[model samples]
Target: MAEKEEYVKLIGSWASPFSRRVEMALKLKGVPYDYSDEDYLVTKSPLLLQLNPIYKKVPVFVHKGKVLLESHLILEYIDQTWTRNPILPQDPYGKAMARFWAKFVDEQVTLIGFRSLVKSEEIDVAIKEAQELITYLEKEITGKMFFGGETIGFLDIVVGSMIPFCLVRGWEGMGIDMIPKEKFPELNRWIEKIKEIEIVRECIPNREKNIEHMMKIVGRIKAASKTA
Candidate 1:
């Protein structure tokens, strides 16, 4: 643990992929802070509601009384504030490309992929869509060590958070193989490479644990639908 700095705080949920991304960035940068785990259901703190009225969600960062909402936005703030190790590239084109892929993950992979998980009937089409997205990533990252190359940059963190969750849920919900070595050799290789990083390996949630949680969530949804 780094020396406790002047009261940096993160309000997030335990299993949120968004929260995990921020946490991983903080850990990687050796930022010392306090973490408050928020409940998505039942209750949300007044402070949380105030900071993020729009989303009314967790994964909010408060640094020295200034609040930041959204995981990607928070990540950019963190990198810019701390000059120690910049997460994004200095080159304009590189930065633009990074931003583009990050947006792709947020728009397509996270939103669409997660929606597909909760409704199993949509799994087949979702799997196909996700494969096409993965194919784009596989093509984009032909010879890079990280998504941003050597040093894992903004895009890496953004996209990396989704991979494990997507893998587990896609397999469990749809019984589809997304990262087969034979089909996506580059992607499979990259997945293995990213996991080798200490920050990623230590912070990423356990795949089995996530699958169990998702199963419980699915069961509840199914029960509610039957009753309705």
Candidate 2:
């Protein structure tokens, strides 16, 4: 692509699932870029605010000075622009199916499902809700390497970004284990397979470390809320 002539930059955070998605996409597609870490809560830089005023979130990609927000959108842009190692399926239906699962997991699993932990009522609903989703996955996803077919595709990147988060917090911290070893064998198998991939392995956060990090953050926020 003509865009390679210009520098590519990514503003991301260390433990953010969203940032990991973009990082994995860029790595999979063989897109060379620089990464700048941003602190979302403490201090956000001017460049980050300017690039993503609406959300002011991390995982913003700057291509030749043009800013792109949202991890999913950035991943699609990288896949289309690079054309090196294609992430999406070629077949039309296959592509749609892959995208469906990806979006479903990204929106529900990561955003809504994970947030359920902090609140007492939300925690119960979150567990039940996650189990329902996993049940559907167990039935629908039978064989075929990934959610797509053979190679790891777009869906893999998005879901994989959440895998570590799920394992660390949802499973280890909360003691939920939505994908119990016996019940969701296929999903567990896929998680094991994903770990073998270097890019996936490297980008995922350290599970134990993240649990501690998250606890500290959550505790501080809860304490502050009580005082307020």
Candidate 3:
């Protein structure tokens, strides 16, 4: 948190869900800032390299001359700094639960589930793991409009950003319906509701492009498997 006059910039990659998460957070908080899309494959900008030396990843948030890495951490910082349109819960217990789900969504859910969409020898197993995660969420999301209920909150942002990339619900990559309507009706309803949110829709990555990328990865893997 800087003083009265501080600059805020979001350096991101177009296809990155992590970047979109930060972007959505900034927009939701009504924070005015410039977005710089870095083509790391083509040209990793000097500014991005300097800001995030360790990871060299996009969605590097520069606020008041301070660099913040990790989308979830940046989100927490945004809520603390903005104080308006607060995304996190005010109560201690509620806040803790939100944080738990956010972390779980990122590490336990997205990390494993998204990889399954890329390229996997055991596609069935990968799909099963993702389905299990979704089923767990399906129960958690029951009766709640969003993860935070009536209003969108921290956990919702974390999980929602990755939904488009998630197999069944998103139809982005494999076009596999990982969370079937009958099996996970609640989660399906929630996904539709979240998609209608303007900010979320604006930040979501393109489905066709996402599917194309997954296809490329699978093709490459098939070629490599033949060679092996």
Off by over 4 Å in 3: 1-4, 118-120, 165-172, 216-228
Point to the candidate with the largest lDDT. 3
Write down the worst ten-residue block by lDDT for model 1.
Answer: 165-174
What are the RMSDs of all candidates, in order?
3.1, 2.8, 3.1
Per-residue alpha-carbon lDDT of candidate 3 for residues 1-228, written as tens digits (9 for 90 to 100): 454356788999876778888888888988888899986656799989888889988889988878899998999999999988889989999899988887788788876665676544787888788788878889889989989878988888888776644333334456577777899999889889988999988887777766665566556656776799
Q: Report the C-alpha displacement of residue 164, candidate 1, in angstroms.
A: 1.8
Model 2 worst lDDT run, 10 consecutive residues: 163-172
lDDT of 2 by residue, 1-228 (tens): 576656899999877888988898888877788999886757899989898999988888988778889887888888888888889887899778877887788776655555554555657777777778767666655786876567777887877787545434645666666677798888878878888999888787877877766666666656776899
Clashing pairs in 3: 168-177, 168-178
lDDT value for model 1: 0.78
Select the stronger candidate by lDDT from 1 and 2: 1
By TM-score, highest first, what's the ranking?
A: 2, 3, 1
